[model samples]
Target: MTDDKTLVSRVLQGDMQAFRLLIGQHERLVAHMIGRLVKNNEEREELCQDVFLKVYEKLSDFSFQSKLSTWVATIAYRHAINWMRKRKMPMTDLAEEDHFKAAFVEEENPESLLSDQDMNGFVMTLVDALPPQYKTILTLYHVDAMSYDEIGQVTGLPEGTVKSYLFRARNLLKEKVKKCIGKEELL
Candidate 1:
């Protein structure tokens, strides 16, 4: 089991198995990014595969001027953008969205949202249901624990916009959490 740098060097030397090692080292990373950036399960799966393929094809271009993760993230961001363009969704501000209002607009009863497991699951499902713009922002902010500037870099949005998106996403989740918790009393 070689390290990433060693494996990268081997892959550069034309060893097919080196690619495997690279995938093994970064598969979870690729999946995490895909899952966060893409809400649709099918597209998430496809995008992950595409990222790995792109990584394999572009191995020669990696000059070690930057870390491997950064290079991979750059590819993922580009692919995600291309995917969004293909889907015909023009740029939209998720910060301006009232996600909870858009999804549950009406006041839901406590029971309507109560078990801790049920509450957590429902909130996560709701996040998953967010539009890609919001979902990507939420995922990058929460799941990846990325900073606003980092998220802005990845999403090609302004740092202020990234901050606003995260703020909005958290507010939406807080509301959902409250509703889910209320179910115990609503019952």
Candidate 2:
């Protein structure tokens, strides 16, 4: 198997196969970041493609200061944020929101009666219903197995900020999951 440096060099030399290999290696990372950040399916797909293109354009500037995946993720995060800004969408800011208020009313919905499998899906839906910042931090930190520093790098946030966001996001998810399962004692 070609190493990342060798593959990168080959891509720099205009090898399409090498470029494709690079894309294949990092596509999932890009998709994970964009998918959680961008809710619209078509927009997510388009933004993902845009991320790779931006990666390609900026490939020469990749200084190996971080892991390749981190660099790719940084690009993905910034691209999604920029896209959101361009669309005039409000970026989720906790300070701008009334944090003390409940995010949703606990109505007697069908989700409360779902099976374990369905409950897991319901949990995911709750996660997805979270603000983009919460979803992004959760996916990047837990699913991507990135350290707070790595998440900070990817999102251009301070490490403390990353940690705080992760803590808050987890708490929010925990509250929502507990509500969905009808088990307040779980927390």
Candidate 3:
């Protein structure tokens, strides 16, 4: 496996091919990570580019004090939050009511991969409805699958805080999803 250290070191040494390799390795991961923070599609894509550009520009400063993925992820997280904050939406924790599985999504048919798309779409709507904080954390947790510690490093919060934010965000999304389902049933 071409580890992050090797790739980062080579790229920092001015290896252009290594840059491509690094981008290939990290582009989707970075995009997905940032995408969770910003809701605007065009802006998200632009921010994704900006995130990589920042990563490239700052490549030399990388001391390998952390893994390349973490370093890059930190960049994405910071910039994504910056963009959100600039747009006047900072992330916040959700209330407890929405956290339980019963509120947002009930268990579904086990044999039904066919329903996955619809379900995911429904979930995405709930996710998008979250406050920027919860949206960002939830996106990082579920979409990027980063650990609490890693997310903390990225967001400049403690690991415990990251976990709390995630919990609150999930609850908020669950509440929204539940409200949406109820509204649909009423119509």
Candidate 4:
């Protein structure tokens, strides 16, 4: 496995294979960032492609100040945000906790009555309903195993803000799961 600096240097020199390698390495990070926010599969796929294209175009500008993955994630985050803005989607701020909680929790649906096997999918659905910032931070920290600082680099939030959001996001999911479990017991 080549180091990121070597791979980036080769890509900057017009090495197509190195560029492919870069894409292969960071593709999951890009997909997870976009997937957490964008619901449409086609759009998500296209957005991932666009992110790499932008990476390639700007490869020379990468100064190695951050890990290659973190830089790529930043691009992915910005692209997803721009896409959402263009579509007139609500970019809800995390400060609106009451509004977020009210909108997120609702009457139990048929899908919420899941057996253990379906619990993972049910939890993901709850995560999907969260605002984009919360979803992005959760995905970056948990799915990608990134540190709060790395997540902050990607999302342009402070480390403290990242930690706060991650904590709040987990708490929100916990409450939702507990609510579902309590309701399931009544059935």
Candidate 5:
């Protein structure tokens, strides 16, 4: 397989196949970033295409300052954010924290939940209930395995803020999972 540098060089020379190869290489990273941010499936698909379009247009300016996936993810993040902003959608709902806390404060038993066969589905539903910003950070950190700095760059957050949000997001998941499972140390 050709390295990113070779593919990039080929694309810079107007190789369409190289551009397609680049898209194939980074599509999952783009999808994962945008999927966590955009809730609408059709819109998410369109946004993914737009991200690659933007990447192709701006490829000449890519300075190799970061991994290609990181750069593509940054574009995907910004594109999703812009799409939400244009639609007047709130990225992070402050009221959600209070509701999440309320859920955490409720009493329940983990043993009962352990009997259910679809624990993974249940946990995904809870994750879906979280704020979009938290979902995005959590996906980037845990799913994409990006560093806090990479997350910060992709989301335009400070490194410390990325770390803080990731920490809080995980705790929120843990708390919610505990609530569902009755305090069996879900995390």
Candidate 6:
């Protein structure tokens, strides 16, 4: 595995293989960032391709102030947000929060309804229902294992804002999961 600087330098020098390597290296990161927001399979694929295209075009402008993966993630995040905006999707509205909170408060202990695998799927489903900003922050922090600062760089959010959103997103998930478990037990 070449270092970022070497790989980037090679790509800049017109090394096609290096460019391919760059794509291979970052494709999963790109896919993860985009997949969480875009539900359509075809659209996700197209968006991923577009993200790489933009990355390649903008490679010369990358300043190396952050990790290369962070730079790529920033592109992925921006593309996903832009796509959502064009579709008029709600980016930050937490309309479901109140419903989940009510359900959570009404329920007692609700953690025993699911096995690990079932809980994982259920949590991911809940995550998919969150607003785009929260979803992006959660995905970048948890799935990608990025620190708050890195997530901030990727999402263009302040470090403190990233932490706050992550905390709120987790709390929302907790509330929703308890509500879901309570409902499941009643069934």
Task: Tell me the deviation in Å of residue 56 in model 2.
Answer: 0.8
lDDT of 2: 0.81
lDDT of 6 by residue, 37-77 (tens): 89999999999999999999999999999999999999999
The sequence of per-residue lDDT tens digits that candidate 4 reaches over residues 72-152 is 999999999999999999888777756456655467553535753476687787788778899889888888999998999
By descending lDDT, how would the candidates be arranged? 4, 6, 5, 2, 3, 1
Runs in model 4 deviating more than 4 A are: 98-112, 183-187
- Whole-model Cα lDDT per candidate? 0.71, 0.81, 0.73, 0.86, 0.81, 0.85
Q: Which stretches of candidate 2 lie over 4 Å from their true place?
A: 96-113, 184-187
Tens-digit per-residue lDDT, 55-161, candidate 1: 98898888776557656766787787788788885545554555445656456555554443475566677786565667777876777667776677667789988
Clashing pairs in 6: none
How do the residues 117-175 of candidate 5 rate in per-residue lDDT, one tens digit apiece? Answer: 47776676566667878888888887789998899888889998888888888788887
Which of 1 and 3 is ahead in TM-score?
3
Clash pairs for candidate 5: 109-181, 109-182, 110-181, 110-182
lDDT of 4 at 26: 93
Q: Which stretches of candidate 3 lie over 4 Å from their true place?
A: 87-117, 182-187
* Better-scoring candidate (lDDT), 4 or 5: 4
lDDT of 5: 0.81
Positional deviation of 23 in candidate 1, in angstroms?
A: 1.5
Clashing residue pairs found in predicted model 1: 110-183, 111-183
Top candidate when judged by lDDT against the true structure: 4
Minimal lDDT window, size 10, model 3: 96-105
Candidate 1, overall lDDT?
Answer: 0.71
Where is the poorest 10-residue window by lDDT in model 5? 102-111
Per-candidate TM-score against the hidden true structure: 0.73, 0.88, 0.76, 0.89, 0.86, 0.85
lDDT, candidate 2, 1-187, per-residue tens: 6777887788889999998999999999999999887888999999999998988898888888888889999999999989989999877675543432244565746354465447656666666667778778988987889988899899999999888888888888786667566687766
Higher-lDDT candidate of 3 and 4:
4
Among the numbered candidates, top TM-score falls to 4
